[model samples]
Target: MRHIKEYDGLRGLMALWVLVGHWAATIYIQFPWPANLGNAYAVDVFVILSGFAIATLVERKRETYGIYITRRVLRIFPVYWFYLAISIALAWVSVDMWTNAAGGEATSNRLQISIAALDNFWPNVISHVVALHGAVPRNMVPNGEYAFLGQAWSISLEWQFYLIAPLVIALGVRAASSFKAGLVLVLGLFVLSYISPRFPYSFIGRYSAFFAIGIATYFLVNVGIPFLTQRRIVIAPIAMLIVTALILLQLPSVLPVSIWIVATASVLVPSQFGLSAIAGLLRWKPVQALGQMSYSVYLSHMAVLVLAMLVLEKAGITSTYLHAALLLIITLAGTLIISIASYNFIEVPFQRLGRNLATRPQAAE
Candidate 1:
C-alpha cells in the first residue's frame, strides 16, 4: 500500500534503457548481442510491475471500481494525448520536408517518411485516439508503423490492462486464501496466452503471463514466501543467470516468456528480503524522480529521436557512430526536459482532478 520508491527507480532505469535501445535500433547500430532483448524484456517488466502496483494499491485503498478506473484514465490519458498531438504535428513536418526535398528531383531516404505518412493517416489517428490500435486485427498505421508514435503499442496494452485491473484485483483477493486457487489463476493466464493470436497483438496473448507474475508476486510477498525471502543472496544470482541465458539463447518459441517471469521475480523477490544495497540503489532520489516522470519520458523519447535524426540528416552528419551518439544525447536531454514539463503541467493536474473526483462523496455511490 505504501509507495515503493524502489519500483520508481526500476522504472526509471527501464525507461532510459528503452530510450537507448530505440536509439541504437533506429540508427542501425548493431550491438554484439541481440538488440531487442533488453528493451523487449523491459516491457515485460513494466507489465508485471503494473499488475503488482495496481493490485497492491487498490487492495490497500479499498478503492471502488469507479474510482480506480477514473484515476487510471486520468493518470494515463492527458500526457498521452499531449504527446499524440505532438506526434501528429511532427508527422506533418516530416511529410512536408520530404515532399520539398523530392520536388527538386533529388533522391533522399527522407521520402520514406512521406510514404509512411500517406499510409492510413485517418485510420491510424482514429485508432490511436480511441486506444484500439494495438487491439485491432490490422495495422493501425501505414506500413505497420504506429504512425509516429511506434512505442505506443505498449501503451495500448497497458490501457487495456487498466480497464481490467479491478477485476484482476477482486479475483486475486478471492484466491488469496488458497495457494492452489492462486496457481489455478496463474495457469489460466498461461492458457489464455497460449490460445491468443500472435497477430493483431492481443494483450492477453502477449502479456498475461507477465501480469500474472506480478499478481503472484504480490501474493507471495503478502503470504511471505520463506524460501524466496530467506535465500535472496543465492536466488538473486541464479535468477539473473537464468534471465541472461534466456536472453542470449533467443529461443524461437515461447521460452522467452519464462525469462520474463523469472526476470520480474529476480528483481522483486530480492528486494522483499530487505536487500539494502539494492533498495538503496533503486531508492536513490534522482532515480526516483526519473521514475516519477517515466511515463512522460517513455512517450516523448521516440518523437525526440525522430526529430534529432532529421536534424542530423539535414546537417549532413553522415558518420554513423557520431550520429548515434549525438542522437542519444539529444534524445535523453530533450526527453527529460519534456517529461518534467508534462509531468508537472499535464499529468499532475489531471491526476489531482481524478483524486478530487474519486474522493467526492457521490463518487462512492
Candidate 2:
C-alpha cells in the first residue's frame, strides 16, 4: 500500500518525452536519439504504469465497486474536465489558424488533431462526457477519441480499465495460482486481440497486454516471486541492453514486447543496492515535481503548443529555427505554470473530496 515515489518520477519523465516529441514533430525537428522522438512508445509506458498502479490500489484497498469507481472518477475527471473546457475554448478561437498553419506537411498532423477536436463538436462533447470516446471508431465518428483533447484518448482508455479492474483483480485472486491465472489472462487477451479488429482500434483490448504486464509485475515483485529480487539489479541493465539492441535491429514485434516487459518489471523493482541507483535518479526532486503534475502537463501541453504556434504564425515568424525555438520556450513556460496551478487547485482538492465521499458509511435499512 505504500506509495512508490519513483513511479511519479517515471511518469514525469514520460510526460516530458511526449511533450517534447510532439513539440519537435509539430516543428519537423528530428532528434538524433531514437527514444527522444518516441511519443507512441512513451504512451505505452503510461499504460503499463497505469496497470501497475491501479493493480496495487485494488489489491490493497477493500472497497465496494461503487466507492472504488467514485474515487477513480474524482481522480481522473476533475483535471480532465478542466482541460476539456480549455480545449473547447481554443477550438472555437484558433481552429482555423491551426487548420491553415504553414510548414505544410510538418504541421498537417497537428492541424488534423486540432480540427477534429471540434469537427463534430457536440458529438465529441457527448462522447468525451461519457468517457467512451476511445471505444467509438473513426468510421462511426471520425476522430472521436482525439476529438476534444487529442491526448485524452488515452484518458478515456484508462477510465475504461478502471471500470473493469476490480473484476480483473477478483478473478486473479480467485485463481490462487499466478501461473494458472497468468495463462488464463494471456489466453483471454489473445482472444480479445483476435476479436479486436471488429472493434475500435483505440479500445482497451488493443492495449490490455501492456496492462497485463503491469499486473503480472505487481504479483512478481510483491507476492509471487521474491526470489527474483536480488537478481533484478543485474536483470535491469540486461533488459535495457536487449531493448536497445532490439531497437537497433528492428526485430520481430514480439521480441520488443517481451524485452519491454522485462524492462518495465525491472524499473518497478524495489530499491536496494544496485537497483537503488536507478531509483535515486528517478526520485530526483525536479523529476518528482514534474511527476506530481504530470497529468496536467500531458493533458494541457497540446493546447499550449497549438495556441503558441498560432500566435507565432500570425506574428509572421518566418524562420523555421526561430519559430521552433520561440514555440518551445513559450509552450514550456505556459505548460509549467498551468500544470502547477491545476495540480494544486483541481487535482488535489477533488482527490481529497473523492476520498471523503468514498469513505462515508451507507445508512442502515
Candidate 3:
C-alpha cells in the first residue's frame, strides 16, 4: 500500500498523454502523435489511481465501517467541492462571455444550468458528485463558448464512482477471503466494462473499466492467488505494450476499451516480473515527479492549449506542427508551475484536512 514509484511514473506518462490528446482537440491538429488517445482513453489512469489509492486506504478499515465511510467522504469531498466551485465559477465566466458578446446578448436554448439556477446549483453539483450527468441527459447543458465544459464529464464520473466505491470495497473486503466471491465480482465488473459502452448515456460506459481494473488489480496483487501474482511483471509490460499499440493504431470502436481492460487485468500478475521488465524504464526519478504532477498537468493542459491557440492566432501561424510544439512547451511549463501551486494550495491542504479529520478524537469518550 505504500506508494509505488513506478506507478507514479505511469501517472506522469498518462497525464502527459492526456495533455497531448486534449491539445490535439482544442488547439492544433497538426501534431505527430496519435489523436486516438483522447481524454476518455487516458483519464482512466486517473480512475485507476483513485481505485488503487482508495482501496489501499479503505481496505485497512475492515473493522470500522463508519470510520471507513467517513474517511472516504473526508478524503474525497473537500477537494471535490473546491474543484466544483472552481468549475462553476469558470462556467459562470464562460457563460457570461458567450451571452454578452460584443454583438450583444445571445440567448441559449438551455438555461436550466444558467446562473439564474445558481441557487439550485446543488442538482447539477450533485449530478456531478454522483457521476450521473451522462446517465441523465440534458442535465448540464453545454456552454457554447466554453470548450472544457465537456471535460467536466470525467470529474462527474469520478465523483459518482467515488461515492459507491466504499460499499464496493466493503463487499470486496468481505469477499476477499472467499476467492470465488472476489472472482465473481471481478467477472461482473469485467462484463460491465465491456458492455457498458453500449448503454447509450450510461455513466458506466467505457470508464467502468478503470474501477474494475483497480479493484481487480488489488486482488491480483495482494490476495496470494497463485494464478494472478505469478506473472505480474510480464503482464505489466505486455499490457503496457498492448495499450501502446492500441493508442498508436488509433483503433476506435472500443479497441481502447479492450486494451485498457487487458492492461488493467495485467496489473494483477503476481511478482513473476511481467511488467517488472520495464520497471527500470518506468522508475526514473523524473518520471515519478511527472506522475506526482499528473493531476495538475491534466487540469491545466486545456488552458495551455488555449494559450497556445491564442499565440498562434496572434502570430498567424497556421501549421499544426508549430502549434503542437507550442502546446507541448506551454503544457509542460504550465503543468509544472500550476501543479506545484495546485499540489501545495489545493491538493495537499484538503488531503491533510481529510486525514486529520478522519484521525481526530471524538468529543467525549
TM-score of each: 0.79, 0.85, 0.67
User: Candidate 1: misplaced stretches above 4 Å?
Assistant: 94-117, 139-145, 175-191, 226-275, 362-365
Which candidate would rank higher by TM-score, 2 or 3?
Answer: 2
lDDT of 1 at 19: 86
Poorly placed runs, candidate 2 (over 4 Å): 28-36, 104-106, 176-187, 227-277, 362-365
Q: Which residue pairs clash in candidate 2?
A: 117-147
* lDDT, model 2: 0.77
What lDDT tens digits, residue by residue, belong to model 3 across residues 48-71? 766776677667644255665566
TM-score of 2: 0.85
- Candidate that would win on TM-score: 2
lDDT of 1 by residue, 1-365 (tens): 24666778888878887888776666645567655436766776777788788778676767788888888889898899899888888887766654543121111333563456457677777877867667665433433335557678788888878887777667677786978667876877777666566445535557776776677667666665555557554455655675567669885423435534443443565454455566677778998899999999999997887787678778988777787689788998999998999999999999999889777866667
lDDT leader = 2
Candidate 3 residue spans exceeding 4 A from truth: 30-39, 63-135, 138-148, 173-202, 225-277, 315-320, 362-365
Q: For residue 325, give model 2's deviation from the true position in Å.
A: 0.9
Better of 1 and 3 by TM-score: 1
TM-score of 1: 0.79
